[model samples]
Target: MSRPQGVGDGGQGHKAKHTVLALAVAALNFGIAQGFFAPLENHPSLLQARLGLEAAQAQLRATQSPVSLQAQGGVSFFEVTPPPGPPTCPNPLNPQCITLPSDGRQITLGLTFTPFPFGDVSDAVNQAAIGVEQAALGLRQARTQLEAQAVEAFLRVRLAERGLEVARLGVRLAQASLEAAKLRESRGAASPSEVRQAEASLRQAALQQADAERNLTLAKQGLADLVGPSSDPPPRLIVPSEGTPPQVRQAELQLANAQVAYDRAVRGVLPVVQGSYTRNTSDNDSLTLSLNSRTLQPSLSYTNQSQGRSAPQDRIVGTLQIGLSANIAFGVLDALEAAQKQVEAARQAVEAARRSSKQQEDLLRSALQTAEQGLANAQQARSDAERSLAEARERERLGLASPLATLQAELALAQAQLNLEQAELGRTQRILDLYRFYALPLSEVNR
Candidate 1:
């Protein structure tokens, strides 16, 4: 006899539809994951870091072009009258001692500039460039930190999910034990106390399952918070690849930045030289040129003047002046000594940072090795527990062991599984932490 044609056709059709559905679901999931991680630069933390880098770059540019220019111009209306007493004029024929004109205007214009010199300005530019480098490093560090946090949160969710599964299994085992105990009591083979104990165990398991469910929900929410809102579920936890530690590099960067700061502080007390020019126009038009340094200043000025009571009687005079001056502030030597001390202090700090980084790297390496050993041990224990449980079940099937003994074996197996899962989670977490210390991107580390 052959199977009905309709029944065989229906089975094949159902399988084909199921396969198509699974493929569509898998494609959708792949697209979602690609979309989530594609725009890494646009992540909120990275965007903020990029802004900080841009600001530092702007400051560096400003320091590179440090020059000051100033211009002033104004118009003034003025009228002058002689005092009540006799006029005190240098020229007796000037205006014939008459009243001054009521309508007169004077225009004034001036321009001054100070160019950036080599001493302080150069130091500032160098410091700003260092700042830009620090900002870039800070951005990289922030990215590393954020990725580590995301992975940690994801792992926590995975751990919670595992815990919930174990809790559910525990409840099932407890209920089965309770049922077996009640059956034995009805058959007069088990005491009432045993039934009561079994009931208590089942209740405890139910409570544990509830707690596990609550924890799982909280974990899922935390994972959602880290990855932002999305319809897709959390991605599977991927173990990161081992890489070289970043502590040494981080220490080097700190030392370089400290050196830059120390150099800037030392330059702060050094001599400064500035060159300046000024042009002024008033009753007298003057042009001034000057060169100034820490100790000496030399200047020259040329002036052209026009003075009279009327336009035709105006007299024009031109004058030239030159001068030199010297200045010595005793405080600059004191400042130099203080800056030297600061440089020494910064040098010491660099050494301290280097030593600390070395210590941290060594400690993490040791911890990673320990965690791997622990995971291996847990896996072996789980294998033994599974084997024992299988033997206990076979013995019960042959009526050579009590139901309670088989249930105990199942409970042991469940505990072993839970321990193994926890050990695995711990190992994964430690590996990720090591990857983070190495400054490896979680996405690339997974690859």
Candidate 2:
């Protein structure tokens, strides 16, 4: 009785599964385009560099307005004090000058100077930092999701590959049984019905074999698509060397790191408030030189002009002045509020993402548990089949079993062996799953 080879060194299966899983993991890693790639791991401050650079350059390029001395052309006005003119004196020609009393007895002219306020270069820096952080955060979220997908794919390939070996063995054993029946029938010992039964069995085995083959083929194709450079499927069951889960802790670790990175990036979304105050003063040379607090008793201005065509007694006078000024604009508060709202929204998104990830972690843990149980059950079934085949062989040797009985025993044995193979396959698959759950690639686990 030729029984299919059921046991393996668990080496080849491990290697194959690990390789495929690794390829899948890498594919996901690259696809994310965010997580590992998006965050400025080495330089969180790099985001602020642009603002810093521009500010430095602007500062260097900044030109200060010279205290310009030029021919002033704008309307200039000022108050002057004249000598106490007799308010009650009604001199015929002086009536218009100072008929009634006035606070200031004279008039004077002065020029006002103002400077335009400019925007800070630092704001541009902050904006760029904000954008970089947002982009980095988005990419990170996508990357983490991809990592999970990769792990799942890797585990799937390993799972399918485990079932392939036994299924093929079943086909080989059935063929052997069918050949034996044909030989016995040709010698007129086996019944036609028996031969036909064997043939049918063989056909069923073949179908199952074909199915396994298809699954493996499809799995290979999937792996190839994920990894740019790949290898053809290796022959035989590939098993991990140590039979241990590889990189099983990586998943949680990666998620943790991602959380921290996202947190830092989020800070950029906060509203930045900026303000400054300045005091300045400038005036015409005459106004500056003549302005004084000295109280003119007469509260008036008088100018005596004895030059050019003016008569020697001709006089013109002006008064002194003092004052305060101010200006204000609205709407800065509204802009600040909008910026704060945007920050709040970004923070909320981060929280939502974290909660979702936690749930995914829980689901993965459940999948791992199921896979472990499946592997154990398959192993137990294989052991039972082996014992049944041994008993059948012994019964046949004693002539207590008919050819049909022996055939049944043989069939049982093949099925048992197939089950064993499946078990071994299942075991390896479970390990792969564990690796994936941890967010580690098959290569690390298999190795």
Candidate 3:
């Protein structure tokens, strides 16, 4: 009562494995373009960086403008009466009752400008410009980080999809094997224990299929969270040739800002020159110029009556004023020394960052090489498994192999194919890591 040696699925399961393999190979030939990452531009961190850049730009604009203008207007009501109860008019019937207007309106316009800024004002501008640069770099760094995340998510989805298909194929092969084992048991040539073993294998395959499905679902959800609800994953890895790592660029900018601070501390002790213009409705129109230093301030001003308001010639005058002031602090020298130290520290940080980046690049290159080797080995194993399965089928046809032997061969082939797919996915991941480390663009579709 022996079951036939060649008993399962005719070659359907084998063909399905081949189909998955072909799909995986096609994926390897297709490279994901940068357009795929465009959807991630709206990621929260990226949006934050963009906002920071805009703020920095506004600050820079404010710093570049040294002049300010202001306008103020108001209405006032007042009454005036002669002191002591006295009638100024001589006529008894018409006493000289002097009365003043009860209400008046006035407007004032003022303008102030720094003709030449000193004592850290110019330094303020330079610092603001540096801040703008830093913000721009930060935005670029955020984009690169988003690209890295997108690539990782993409890899997970691709691997999970392949795993789910492979698991399904495994289930099918297991079911076929179990059916052959049952036939043998019904023929009284196989024990109940053997049938139970086949059942156990089927259950294991089902469990694996369920796990694969869960993983794929989770991978898809994570990807959607990153890019959007609709994500079209790229077929394969995209690696750019070269780029400066964003961290190193950011550190260099920091060093520049530090250097600027040091320069400001050394050169910010010069005198300042300022000018102002003021217009008033009731009093005078004035133009003033001044020079100020830490120890002294000298100013010259000219005032004249308004065109529509009459005034004595004496009201128009020129005035010169000189004021002396001093402020001595214990930490002035210490502050300069501290700024110098910061510059040196920032320079050192830049060097350290460069060294660390280079080390990371070397490590990634080594890892990529290892991944390539692993992929080659997996492909070789799959080839061997295919040969073994073919041999097993030929033996069964010649009546030289048992049903159990053929089933094992088929299982080996399925596992080898799965391993090959996984290896391919791993190699793509290594390439992505290398590209991401360099802050290189992953896609050139739009470039």
Candidate 4:
């Protein structure tokens, strides 16, 4: 009230605005979280992969169950006419001849189980089981890739924000420089050329601001495309100390599948054994057992039947049969050789994948070390800029330097700060690359 506090209200408002902006900037600098990728679960590609895995699992279950059941029902009608004279009345017959109409209905339900005593059934089941495992690994591979993409998108947004912050500071410094130059020109201390240079610098700063704004907008859009318009800051990504690369596991599964195939091919036309028990509504029950090879089959069956309800007499029958067969085809041998080759190829592929993975891990570690060095350089540059800015301000206060020089020093400090941020981003990116390469989960926030 002594000098009217309202006069300083504009300064207070500016301070408040700057404070809000600072907070906003701080909020933008958040780490990634496991929940950041929650929306990825519903992504179409991931959903499709999940469905594929489910289908593979269902196929496995079906292969494991060899039993089957069938139900059948039918109706039949018939009419019979007696011959006209009934064999010229050779036997005593009724004078009136009539047509007989008959209708029959039957319902049958049958249950059968066929078990392969040889390796055929086991081989098929194992193949199906392997398919399920492969599908599962495929899903994991897809998820890891998607998570890496999300991380990159998030980093892009953060980088854009940081760039924008630097651009804004640049604009402010340029504006201050332009004002100082105009004042000096009005006092005959600076020439018109200096004023024009200051104006050009301001325009350049404005251009940079525009570019940064555009970049930020694009980055935000890209991030929204993946996570669907997330306003909350992402949590920091935590790198795991150790983990297996997805490629290694995928290669291992492939090797397993190939080995199974090779084993089946090596079996080379084995014998088969089957047993079945079937019952139907026609009062018929049967058990059949068979053992067969490519060249011969021996079968035994037992049946119990009641022909009609009126008779109600049980009939029992047993039958044995032997069948001989021959196949001139020699494709089995060729298949065995091919399968052997495939097994060898898969083994080699596994080794190759492991080697490639190790190489990538080593490369990422080296890159991370390089990123650390870059960050250190940026920190040192920023320190030097800070000292220069302080000296410039002191000189300006002592009337030994122009205000524009002080502003230029401030701009340099801002640039150094931006470089430090970029270096940090680079380091984070290298770490993320390592994490993705290892297929490590990003949920470990403690680290």
Q: Which candidate ranks first by lDDT, i.e. highest? A: 4
- Winner by lDDT between candidate 3 and candidate 1: 3
* Local distance difference test values of all predictions, in order: 0.67, 0.47, 0.72, 0.73
Q: What is the TM-score of each candidate against the true structure?
A: 0.68, 0.40, 0.72, 0.73
Ranking 2 against 3 by lDDT, winner: 3
Report the lDDT tens digits of candidate 3 across residue range 1-447. 664688679566887899999887655434334346767777889899999999999998886666766566677777766634464655444434534456666555555455554445566777888889888877766776777677678778877887887788778778887998899899998999999998999999999999999999999898888877655565355544556776788788889889888886665443343333332323446556555553123333444433334345435454455554443467778888999999999999999999998898888878888989999999999999999999999999899997667777877887787788788777877887776676554553122
Residue 3, model 4: lDDT of: 52
TM-score sort, best first: 4, 3, 1, 2
Candidate 1: stretches off by over 4 Å: 1-50, 65-117, 229-327, 389-414, 435-440, 444-447
Local accuracy of candidate 1 as per-residue lDDT tens digits, 334-374: 66666666667766776776677668767777887888899
Kindly give the number of clashing pairs for every candidate: 0, 35, 2, 6
Model 4, 167-250: lDDT tens digits are 998898889988988988999999999999989999999999999999999998988888887765556655556577878878
Clashes in candidate 2: how many? 35
lDDT of 3: 0.72
Residue pairs in candidate 3 whose N, alpha carbon or C atoms collide under 3 angstroms: 34-443, 89-96
Candidate 2 wrongly placed segments (more than 4 Å): 1-169, 172-198, 221-334, 393-447
List residue ranges in candidate 4 displaced over 4 A: 1-32, 71-118, 273-316, 320-328, 394-402, 444-447
lDDT of 2 at 40: 29
- Give the better candidate number (1 or 4) by TM-score: 4
